[model samples]
Target chain A: MRDAYHDELRALTGRLVEMTRLVRSAMSRATTALLDSDLPLAESVISRDKDVNQLCEEIETSIFGLMATQQPVAVDLRTVITALRMAADLERMGDLAVHVAKIARMRHPDSAVPAEIRDSILEMGQIAERLVTKTGSCILTQNAELAQELEQDDDHMDRLHRRLFRMLLSESWEHGIEPAIDITLIGRYYERYADHAVRVAQDVVYMVTGSRVGE
Target chain B: MRDAYHDELRALTGRLVEMTRLVRSAMSRATTALLDSDLPLAESVISRDKDVNQLCEEIETSIFGLMATQQPVAVDLRTVITALRMAADLERMGDLAVHVAKIARMRHPDSAVPAEIRDSILEMGQIAERLVTKTGSCILTQNAELAQELEQDDDHMDRLHRRLFRMLLSESWEHGIEPAIDITLIGRYYERYADHAVRVAQDVVYMVTGSRVGE
Candidate 1:
C-alpha cells in the first residue's frame, strides 16, 4: 500500500511534466503563428488548449483520490498540494499562449507584431519557451537550484516587455492606436506567461525543500 | 477532537470571508483613486495589499496544520482544499486592485481615465465592487445559488471590457498612445478583478455542492 501511494505521487509528477511540454509547444507554435501570421498554427494552438485543461482535471482527480485513500502526511501531503498549484499555473500558461494565438488570428493576414517591435516579441516568446522548458526540468528533477534560474529568466522577460512598451511609446512609432493596443496586450500575455512559468518552478522548489523561495 | 477540528474549518471560512472584505475595500478605493486622481487613496490601496497577503498566509498555515494533524477526508477534505483555492483567488484580486491603484498613482494629478471613457470606467468599478460584495456573501453563506449570480456580473464586466476597447480604437480617440496604453492596462485590471471574484464564488459553489458550476 505504501509503495502504491509513492507510485501514485510519481505518476502525478509525470503528468505535471507532460503539462509543461504541452504548454511549451503551445507557446512555441503560438509565437510562430504570431510572427508569420500563420492562421493554421494559431488555430491549432487555440484548439489544443483543451488538452491542457483535460490534463489539469486529471491531475486534480488523482490528487483527490490519493488524499482520500492515502491521507499522505507531512512532506508527502505538501507534495500533492503543490502539484495541484503547479498544474493550475501550467493550465493558466496554456491559456496565455492561446491569448497570444488569438491575437495572431484576430489580425489574420496582418501580423500583430509591428516590424519595429517584432524582434522584441520574438525574444519575449523565446524567453517564455525557455522558462517553461526549465520549469519542466525543475519538476522532473526536483532541482531547487534549477528553479532559482527561472527568476533570472523572468527578469529578462520583464526587461523585454518594458522595451516593447518603449518602442510603442517612442516618437518614431507610426503604427497608431490599433497596433499599440495589440502590442500592449501581447506584451502583457508574454510577461504573464513568464510569470506563471516562474511560479511553477517555485512550486517545484517548495515541493522539494518544503520552504518557499525568496521567503 | 472532532469538535476542535470542525471549529478550525469554520475559522478557515471566516478568514476567507475576511479576505473578500479586504480585497473589496481595496478595489473600491482603487477605483475611486483612479477616477478622482487621488494619490493618498491609491497609496492606501497599494499598502493595504500586504494585509491581504498576510491573511492568506495565515489561512494557508491553518490549512496545512489541519491537513497534517486531522487528516480530514471526504467533504471535510474538500472544504479545506477549496478554501485554499479561494484564498488564492482573493489574493490575486488584491493584486489586481493594486495594479489599478498603481496606475492611478502613476498618473497622479493627471487622471488615467479620459472624459470620454470615464463613465465606462466608473461603471466597471461599480460592477467590480458589486461582484466582490456578492463574493463575500457567497463565502459567508455558501449559497451555491448566489454563486450563480457572479457569472452574470462577469458577463457584464466582459461587455464593459469590450466597450472600453471600442472607445480606445475609435477614430475619435485623440489621447495618443500613452493614455491609450494606460486605459488598456487599466481595463484589463478591472476585468481580471471581476474574473477572480467570480472564481472565488465558483469555489464556494464547488465547496458546497461537491460539483463545479460550469462543468
Candidate 2:
C-alpha cells in the first residue's frame, strides 16, 4: 500500500512537469505566431491545445485515483490537489496564448499597427516569454521567490497593456474597425496571460506554504 | 473501506457546495456594487475575498486529504480533480467581481454616459447574475447542458461588451477620465465574468462526460 501511494505521488509530480512543458511549448509557439504574423502557426497552437487539455485531464484522473486508492494525507494530498489546480491554470494559459495568436491574425499586410503598438507588442512578448519560463520553474522547483516574482512581472505586463490600449485610444490611431478590434483582443490576451501566470505563482505558493495567497 | 470512501466523497461534495455559495455571494455583491455604484459594497467584496481565498485553501486541503487516504482510482480520481479546478475558476470569478467594485470608486456621479451605456451595464449585470447562478448549479448537479446554456450567454455578453467599448472610444463626448476608466473597467469585468462562467461549464462537461469540452 505504501509503495503504491508513493509511486502515484511521484507519478503525479512527473505528470505535472510534463504538463508545464506542454504549456511552455504552447506559449512559445503562440508567441511565434504573434511575432511572425503566421496564421498557420496560430492555427497549430489552436490544434495542439488538445494535448495540454489532455494532460490536465490525465492529472486530474491521477488525483482522483490517488484519493480512491491511496487516501493520502496532509502534504501529499496538498501536492496532488495542487497538481490538479496547476494543470487547470496551465491549460487556460495555453488557451489565452492561442487567443492571442488568433488576435494577431487581425492585421492585414497593408493594415499593420502603427510603430507605437508594434513596439509595445514586441516588448510585451519578451516579458510574457520570460514570465512563462519563470512560472514553469516555480512549479518544477517549488521556488516561492520565483512564484513571488510573478506578481511583479504581471505588473510590468499590465503597464505595457495599458500603454498599448492608450495608444489605440489616442487620437493618433486611424479610425478603423479591424485595427481597433485587434488592439482590444490583444490587450485582453496579454492581460489574461499575465493573470494566468499569477495563478501559477499562486499555485506554487499554495503548494509550499499552504497559505491563502491573495491576488 | 467502500463506506469510508463514500463518506469522503460526500464530504468533498458538501465543501464544493459551500465554496459555490461563497462565490455566488461574492458575485452578487459585485453586481450590487456595479448597479448601485456602491463603493462600500465593493469594499465589502474586496474584504470578503480573504474569506474566498481561505475557502479555496480549505477545499484543496480537504480534497488532497481524501485522495491521500482513499487512493481511489479511475472515475473517482477524475471527480476530485475537477473539483480542484472548479474551485480555482470560481475563486477567479469572485476576484473579477471585486475588480468591478474597485472600478466603481472611480466613476463620476454627475457625468452622464449615453443612454445606451446605462442600459448595457444594467444588461451586463443581469446576464452576469444569470451566469453565476448557472455556474453554481453546474457545479452542484454536474449539469453540462445547463453550463452550455451559460456559454451561449457569454456570447451575448461579449457582443454587448464590444458595443460598449466602441462607444467609449468614439470622440463623441466630454466624459471625464475617471468615468471612462470606470466604464472600461466595468465592461472588462463583466466580459471576464462570462469567460470564467464558460470555464466552469467546461469543467462540468468534463466531469459528466469524461471528455474535455472545447471552447
Candidate 3:
C-alpha cells in the first residue's frame, strides 16, 4: 500500500509536467497562429485547451485522493497542496493561450498584430514559449533555483511589454482605435501568460524549499 | 470536539465572507479613484490588498489545519476544499482590484476613463460591486440558487464591457492611443473582477448543491 501511494504521488508530479508541456505547446502554436494569420492553427490551439483543462481536473482529483487516502504529512502534504496551486496556474496559462488563439481566430486572414508591433509581439511570444518550456523543466526536475530564475527571464518579457506599450502610446501610432485595442490586449495577454508561468515556478520554489520566497 | 469542529467550519465561512467584503471595498475605492483622479484613494486600495492577501493566507492555513486535524470525510471534506478554492478566487479578486487601483495611480490627476466612456465604466464598477455583494450573501446563506444568479448579473457587466469596446472602437473615438489602452485595461480589470465574483458564487453553488453548475 505504501509503495502504491508513492507511485501515485510520483504520477501526480508527472501529470503536472505533462500539463506544463501541453501549455507550452498551446502557447507556441497560438503565438505562431497570431504571427502568421493561420486560422487553422489558431483553431487547433483553441480546441486543444480542453485537453489541458481535463488534465488539470484529473490531476486535482488525484491530488485530493492522495491526501484523503494516504494522509500525506509534512513536506508531502505541502507538495500536494503546491501541486494543486501549480495546476491552477497551468490551467490559467492554457486559458491565456486560448485567449491568444481566439484573437487570432477573430482576426482571421488578417494578423491581429499591426505590422509595427508584430516584431515585438513575436519576441514576446518567443519569451513566453521559453518561459513555459523552462517551467516544464522546473517541474520535472524540482529545480527550485532554476524555477526562481524564471522571474529574471520574466523581466525580459516585462521590458518587451513596456516597449510595446511605448510604441502604442507613441504620438505617431496610426493604427486606429481597433488595432490599438488589439495590440494593448495582446501585449497584456503575453505578459499575463508569462506572469502565470512565473507564478507556477514560484510555487515550485516554495514546494521544494518549504519557504515563501516569492511574492 | 465535533461541535468545536463545526464551529471552526462556520468560522471558515465567516472568514470567506470577510474576504469578499474586503475585495468589494477595494473595487469600489479603486473605481472611485479612477473616476475622480483620486490618487490617495487609489493608494489606499493598493495598500489594503495586503490585508486581503494576509486573510487568504490565514484562511488557507486554517483550512489545511482543519483537514489534517479532523480528517473530515464526505460532505465535510468537500466543504473544506471548496473553501480553499474560494479563498484563492477571493485573493485573485483582490489582486484585480489592485490592478485597477494601480492604473488610477499611474494616470494620477487625470481620470483613466475618458468622458465618453466614463458612464459605461461606472456601470461596470457598480455591477462588479453588486456581484461581489451577492457572492458574500451566497457564502453566508449557502444559497446555491442565488449563487447561480450572479452569472446573470455578470451578463450585465459583459454588455457594459461590449458597450465600452464599441465606444473605443468607434470611428469618432478621439481618445488617443494611451487613453484607449488605459480604458481597455481598466475595463478588463473590472470585467475580471466580476468574473472572479461569479467564480466564487459558482463555488458556493457547488458547495451547497454538490453540483458543478458553471464552467
Clashes of each: 0, 21, 0
Q: How high is each candidate's interface RMSD, in Å?
A: 0.5, 5.7, 1.5
Candidate 3 docking quality: incorrect, acceptable, medium or high: medium
Better candidate by DockQ, 1 or 3: 1
- DockQ computed for model 1 against the true two-chain complex using alpha carbons: 0.93
Q: Which candidate, 1 or 3, would have the higher lDDT against the true structure?
A: 1
On TM-score, who's better, 1 or 3? 1
B1-215, model 3: which lDDT tens digit per residue? 78979999999999999999999999999989989999999999999899999999999899888877787766787788889889999999999999999999998887777888878878888999999999999999988888768989999998999988888888888867888889889888888889889999998888887778779
Q: Candidate 2's residue-wise lDDT over B1-215, tens digit each?
A: 87988887777667666766776677777766666767777788889988877877787777666666676567777777777777777778778877777665445243223444778887887888787777777777877789779888998999999888777767673553434555666787788888877887787788789887765
Name the better of 2 and 3 by DockQ. Answer: 3
Candidate 1 residue B108 C-alpha distance from true site, Å? 1.1
Instruction: Write candidate 1's Cα lDDT for A1-215 as tens digits.
Output: 89999899889999999999999999999999999999999999999999999999999999999999999999999999989989999999999999999999999999988887888988998999999999999999989999889999999999999998899989999989999999999999999999999999999888888888863
TM-score of every candidate: 0.99, 0.79, 0.98
Q: Which lDDT values do the candidates have, in the order given?
A: 0.93, 0.73, 0.89
What DockQ do you compute for every candidate structure? 0.93, 0.29, 0.67
Show pairs that collide, candidate 3: none
Off by over 4 Å in 1: none
Q: What ordering of candidates by lDDT runs from best to worst?
A: 1, 3, 2
Give candidate 3's error at residue B185 in angstroms. Answer: 0.2
